[model samples]
Target: MKNVIEDVTCAGCCCVCDHIQVTTDGQQIIDVQTTCPQGQAWFAQSRQTEKQQPLIKGIDASREAAIARAAGLIQEAQSPLLCGMGQSAVDAQRAAISLADLTGATIDSGASAATRALQQVGEANCTLGEVRSRADLIIYWNAENLRFNAHHQQSLVPPGEPVPRKIVTVGSELPGDSRGVDLSLTVSVEDEFEILWRLRALLKGVALEGTTAGELASLAALMQQSSYIVIFFGPASPDERLFHRKLEALSLLAREIQAERRCHTINVPAAGATKGAEPVLAWQTGYAAAVNFAAGYPRFSPCEYSTVKMLEQGEADLCLLIGEDPLTGLSDQAIQRLQQIPLIHVGPVPLVDLQPEVYIPTGISGIHAAGSLYRFDGTPLPLRALISTQQASEAEILNQIETLLKPVMHIC
Candidate 1:
């Protein structure tokens, strides 16, 4: 017999979409509805039979033995790094942080590109609900085809809405579809800062004297006319240092716009557990990302405490990565460095090429396990399990590992 489940939260991306429907045949998920392609894939993959078992040095081992071995690695290492918390549950993130604290390890989300940008130049943002219901003038700045999902586009100018929200894109290339954007300004990536500065000046009734005056004037007119404006930008760039400067300019522009209008700037981050990890780390450690507790307390340093930086510097000899694929966002250099260390991965999927010393398979949060996930705007949403799985949740595995490490710590 098949049962229909409504309002199932999806763990696919940072959106943490909660209005999903799943059709289950008691033991397996048969269908997923009311979700995007990404969410659908996440649900489907959850039911697949290719689950991983715990391993010790490439050999199959029981859960207890695997946990013991993982604990031993942490106990023996001079310096350990715990990272990849962005794709796990909040409870799991807490456990990982606690474990790091206990073992004097450096902790990072590994998905710190966007977070680093945000930290450099603080954001003035709002909830997705605010963007959907209140925003009338939406600007997709430098985020033509990079960020935004199907749900995000739909919510920008929702169907049957009384007031029509105008969409504008400012970048080197306009986004592919015309349906999502009403206006497209072909602005060079190098000149993005100049364009934003001109807009801010125009808003202040400054005379336009340059070649880009006409374009900036037009954008300024739209902003002045709209009651509410929301600007979205993704800080994914080739040059990391340049990206931070652009983000600072963008943030300043948003603040300047707010002096006259209701403007909110949203930093569209790369999806996964990043949204979940940010708030948890901030509340617990007083910093958002790339933190080290090795000094007996939390110390924030994006450059120094970054997972990739720590690995490359050989500051950490062992890694306890939780609930994220290491290869997905890591740079080639970082990947190469990780290959030389002892890694213990706790997640559903295994790394293909560079195998970890310890691999403990776990359930995907919000699909096979119930937990809390934060949305892009930092709103916490409850996730429901659609089906049962023998594999443990990331939180469960981390907690078990933490428990096992306690005795070893006493002995050492």
Candidate 2:
């Protein structure tokens, strides 16, 4: 018998698209109805046979044994780092934070760069619904097409909307489809900060001495005429410093626009659970990301508490990676350093190249397990499982590890 599930959340990307309709047949997701390609891929990959087993030292092991081995690694290490909360559910992230506190480990998300950048530039944003229903002028600033594709564009304007929304793209590369974008301004990524600053100045009618003033003025005129403006920024650039500057400029521009009219900035993060992880970390530890719980409390240190920095400095002897694969996001240098340490991974193994000492297989959120996830706009959505799995959820695995570590923690 086939069953249909509606309003199923997709934990595929930061978008957290929750309106997916899943068709399942007795513990298997037969089909997924969603506009996002990533969401489709997430549901398709959930049923792969390779992702259904727990492994200890690359050998198949029981869940209990794998959890025990993972706990042993954490217990033996002087400094253990917990990373990769971006792919797990919010409940899993909360459990990971608790485990970090219990073990005095450092916690960081895969989207730490974007999180740090957001911290540098305070948020002046609104929900996707607000942008769709009200925004007249939409700006894609340094937006990546793969992450923010045509589906996103459709979502913003939607179908049957009579309001003629003017879409603009300001980035190094012009998006593939010019039909979706009303205006395309191609500027090098390095010059994004300057362009944004000049545009903001032009909007405020304080422009003087610039060859690009005419272009800036043209863009400013659109912003001035629009009732609601929404700027979508994708900050997944290779250059970290440049990304920060872009974010700062975007924030400043949003503030300037808000001074005159309604303006909202949307940060399109590259990780799946980044939107969810930030709030869980903030509510539990009083900080957003890159936190250390070694002092018996949360310590905010964006630079020092970062997973890459911790690995680079050799401060953390053991690493606990949750949900996502560590090799996927880590830099080459960070991966090399991680390979030297004792690593415990609690999720589906995306690749076996950088195999951890212990791998405890876990179900994917919103696919094989049901939980809550946060949308890009920080809105909580229900994640319904489309299939059942023998593998434990990331939260359950972390909690079990916590249970095992509590007695050892008390003895110390």
Candidate 3:
């Protein structure tokens, strides 16, 4: 028999479109409708891997032995770090954090830079629903492809809008022509920071003596004409060393505009492993990411506790990867450093080719296991299981690991 599930949510990206319909056979997903190209690929999962058994040191082992070896490693390591919570389910991350507490391990959510920016200077945020219905003007700032949300353009800028919504873009790379963007202001990569700060000053009526001030007035004039404006920011470039400062400037600019017109700014990165990791961390640890529990209490340190920093400095003795991202976008040196460590991975097979010391394959969330996934706006949605699988879920694997370690370690 085939089951046609309704109102299914797509975990393909951070967009988290919740109005999908999925057709699943007893063993695999047959069809997924009302989703994007990425979601379709994620739902069907064309590249099928054979069922894997738990492995220890490149050698297949019993599930019991794999868990025992993993617990033993966690117990023996002096400086263990648990990274990759962004790829797991909400219920699963708690288990990972509990295990970290028991073993005095640090956890990185991969949102270290963004979390730090939010903590330093909070963002004026709005939901996708509000942006679609209420916003009269939309600004895409240093953002490309609107964070890879294929459905956002149609949903937000629907046809027959009363006022013909104005679209504005600011960045070195701006999309035009068919995107229907009305305005494009170009800023050099090196000068983006100065331009944003100058615009904020211009909005404040601060007198300026240069042509740069005149150039900024046009954007300010646009802002003054709109009743509701929302700025969508993409991830900072890897070359942007002053990312935090730029975020601060953008946030303050939104805040400044809010005094006169309702204005908001947001960051909606593409959906991936660490997509919604910040919410769980903020609620559980009082900080968003780059958290350490070595003292048996959570401590926030963006620079020190980051997974990249730990690998780069060779500070971590053991790594417990608990999500599906596989640690992509890391420097080659960091990737090479991870190869040298004792790795205990409890989720999907990593994309990179580093063999693990202990491997426990898990069913993909929203495909074989049900859980909660957060949208880009931090709205939590129900993720339904589309097929039956013998493999355990990420949450189950992490919980089992935590349960095994409780008897051996002291948990205060």
Which residue pairs in candidate 1 have backbone atoms (N, alpha carbon, C) closer than 3 angstroms, thus clashing?
86-273
What clash count goes with each model? 1, 0, 4
Tell me the TM-score of each prediction against the true structure: 0.92, 0.93, 0.93
lDDT of 2 at 255: 82
List model 3 lDDT by residue over 1-412, tens digit each.
8989888887777677787888877777788886488778777652242266789998988878888899889888999998876657788887787787778889878777787778888988988888888888888877666633567675575445564578788778765543667677877777878888888877778766665565567777888889999888777665344677778888888888888889888786743433657888889899888889988799998789978888889989999887666575456777888889899988755445778899987788888888997777778888777777777888888888888888778543
Q: List the residue pairs that clash in candidate 3.
A: 14-271, 86-273, 86-274, 87-273
| Candidate 2, 1-412: lDDT as tens digits | 9999888877787776667789999778888898667778888877673456777878888888989999999999989999887767888999999999999999987556656667777878888888878889988777655335555655666556567678788878875867766677888876777888888777778855766666667788888889899888875565354465667777888887787789988877654334647778878887777899899888988778877788878888999888765545566678788889998888765446778888887788888778898777777888876777887789999999999999999899
| Whole-model lDDT values for every prediction | 0.77, 0.78, 0.77
| Per-residue accuracy of model 1 over 1-412 as CA lDDT, tens digit each | 9999988887777677777778999788888886477777777777552467788889999988888888888888988988886667888888888898888788887546556667776788898888877889989887654335676666555446556778888877665766756677888778887787788788889898877778778888898999889888754554354566677777888888888788888766654433647788878887777888778898888778878788778788998888756455566777788889999998888767878899988888777888898877778888777778898888888888888888777675
Q: Cα miss at 273, model 3 (Å)? A: 5.7
